[model samples]
Every structure is written in structure tokens, then in C-alpha cells.
Target: MQDGTVERMPRQDDAIRNLTMVVYILQIVNLFGVPGAIVGVIINYVKRDEARDTLWDSHFSWQIRTFWWALLGAAISYPLIILFGLGFLTGALVWCWYVYRIVRGFLAFNDGKPLPR
Candidate 1:
């Protein structure tokens, strides 16, 4: 109000938005890898019920889907790599796709845009 801003965000929304970024950052860091990502997903799921009425719910959904699909890709492709030496390419492509999704979601969150379903 002192700055004469027309609108202000609630503290809860701010926290949700910040946490969304943390999840994405943890995944991209790759040292935590999927396990770190799993932690993020668990947080998302636990907070998701509270998030249901807020804009940040979209982020939770986006992150959860991203984690599962990436896991599926790794599970399927790694075996191919181990057995036939052919899954490496697929695995790399999947990883790239996951990165893209994470970046896209982050950008949307930053821009205050709703993620596409």
C-alpha cells in the first residue's frame, strides 16, 4: 500500500510460487537426479490439496506429470541401453524433453501465465 501497488499477492501464493521454482531447480541440478525430483513431487502432492483453490495448483500438476513421464522414460530406455545399447539416444532425448518442460513451466510461472494443460 505504501508503494501504491494496485494489487498484492497473498503470502501463501508467494510461498507456493517460490517452492515451484525450487522443485524445478532441484531437478535441473541433476545431482539429486530423480530422487531429488521425487522429493519435490512428494511436496507437491502433499501441498496440492491446499493449493487446489490457488493459481499455483497448475504448477503442482505440471511438476507431477513431468516427474512421472521422465521416470517412465528412464525406466524404459535404460533397460534398452543395458541390453541392446540402443536406448542411450532415447534416454538423452527424453532428458532433453524433461529439461524443456521444466524450463517452459518456470518461464510461465515467472511470467504469471497459466501453464497449458
Candidate 2:
């Protein structure tokens, strides 16, 4: 400690706000499925530091994992959609849930609340 020097604390609200923006942007991309996954990876890589926070690390990690899963799901579902229409629907639903989780986690993190395990 020094005179005229102040330590800065991490702002939970700011982290949540930034994450909320990321989730909304991702939701828009998610509509396009695999293409959205690619965009998400790019966005996440570019904003990795901003996306990082003590309370939100799990959320960010899950976002990356879900992106990969959606990417794989899209690739697998495309060729099987004809034989198994349900594959496409299932992938879309999973992707939607992934986005929903991100939003929920962001809100929770912003409120300085513990995440549900």
C-alpha cells in the first residue's frame, strides 16, 4: 500500500454486462447453426481476456465446449437429416439450450451469485 494509490476490485456488474452482450450476439449467430459456431469461436478467441472472470470462467468454458459440440452436431446432422429428421431438430435444440445457459450463467455471475452445479 502507498499514499494516493488504490487497489481496484473486479466489478461483477461489468463482467455480467459484457457477458450479456456476448450472449445476445451469440444468440443471433446461433440461428445459423454451424456457421454460428465458427463465428463464436472466432469471437471468443478475439475476446478471450474480456470474457474471463473468476465467477464466469465456467460459463466461458462451457461456451467454447458448446461451440465445438454444435459444430460437430451440425456437421453430423446435415448428411443424416434426410434419413433422420430428428437429428437436425435435436442439434438445433441443443444449440438453443447452450445459448440459454450462457445467458443464465451471465446473469448469475453478474448478481454475485453462486452457479448451480
lDDT of each: 0.84, 0.62
lDDT by residue (tens digit), candidate 2, 10-117: 776566556545654674566754355456566656666665655555555556666677667767777777777877787677667766765775566567564543
Shift in Å, residue 110, candidate 1: 0.8
Task: Report the C-alpha lDDT of model 1 over 1-117, residue by residue, as the tens digit.
Answer: 678877865788788877888887877775345468888888898888877777788888998999999999999999999899889998998888998998999888888877766
Clashes of each: 0, 0
Q: Which residue segments of model 1 deviate by more than 4 Å? A: 1-10, 31-34
Global fold similarity of model 2 (TM-score): 0.55
Most TM-score-accurate candidate: 1
